[model samples]
Target: MNTTTVITHQPVAPAPVVVKITERDWSTSLCGCFDDMASCMYGMACAPCFACKVSSKAGENCCAPCCVPGAMIAIRMKVRTRLHIRGSLCSDCIIDSCCGPCSACQLSREIDNSCNGHLM
Candidate 1:
């Protein structure tokens, strides 16, 4: 007597994983005050306003963007997580809270860089 065996394979393969990263490092550093004169001036003149504008340009609410407590930290975390930027929430909070103007300038630069330097 003889026996026959048959084998079958899946038609489609598994989907590929996609990862999105913002950039290797921040467009500007926390103390790089002269990196972006405009951004630095704006941040220094009005940190809240600058943060709000940055948030708006980055697809977030314009008003009260950084007015609320922990708002900057929250936004930073959100942006970092979405863009796959490596950082901790605690560090974000500390940085934003300690250096408001620097943080705002950095955030603005980051958003602009992420959006390819366009007014998105």
Candidate 2:
């Protein structure tokens, strides 16, 4: 009598699971300009310098925001995406272009509130 046996083998263990990187909601709102008085004053006093400082705190090129036309928009987008804010790049650009000081102030306030005035 002859018996036939089938052997089943499993392939290498399933590849390690890939985790999706998800960001969290923003700490503050885009239009919350008056939330921080000091930031507002700094931004209002000197838009370029204020923007540069905000950009620096956000881990970006310190001089880009002042030298580049759309740099403020980029910085806003970065913070938005990093903080998981729901907004469009076009809107950010418009805000950056139309109200440079306000945008910088808001962004500065956001970073400060989120990080407690510490680099993240």
Candidate 3:
């Protein structure tokens, strides 16, 4: 007598993981420039250079601030939008215009914070 054996297999796929992050405030306030002394000093010492550095860190052309008109406000807006931080273009314009260095420092801190996992 001969016996036959049958084997069956089932493949299970895991559900795709989904993560959602809500909009929130900036890691550091605009006037909270002193929170990061290094960036604050850098921005104070050389505003343009600081803006360029921040632009680069923000994944924008390093020369954007130097070459583009209103690049400071644009960079600020970009950072705000990319990070989903709560703000408005009018606010960005006012901040970037009146507080250029502070804005740059704020953007730098925000980028650093987000990169360091403060994004949650």
Best-matching candidate per TM-score: 3
TM-scores for every candidate against the unseen true structure = 0.72, 0.75, 0.77
Please list the C-alpha lDDT of all candidates, in the order they appear: 0.74, 0.80, 0.85
* Prediction 1 global C-alpha lDDT: 0.74
33-111, model 2: which lDDT tens digit per residue?
Answer: 6577778788888888888899899888899976887888988898888777777999888887888888888788878
CA lDDT of 11 in candidate 2?
A: 62
Write one digit per residue (lDDT tens) for candidate 1, span 1-120.
999876687579789999854545665577877767998998889887888877776667777564567777777777666666678888898998798778877777777777664334
The backbone clash count of each candidate, in order, is: 0, 0, 0
- Superior by lDDT: candidate 1 or candidate 3: 3
lDDT of 1 at 105: 79
Which tens-of-lDDT digit does each residue in 75-105 have in candidate 3? Answer: 7888788888998999999988888889988
C-alpha positional error of residue 1 in candidate 1 after TM-score superposition, expressed in Å = 32
Better of 1 and 3 by TM-score: 3
Off by over 4 Å in 1: 1-23, 117-120
- Report the lDDT of model 3 for residue 61: 83
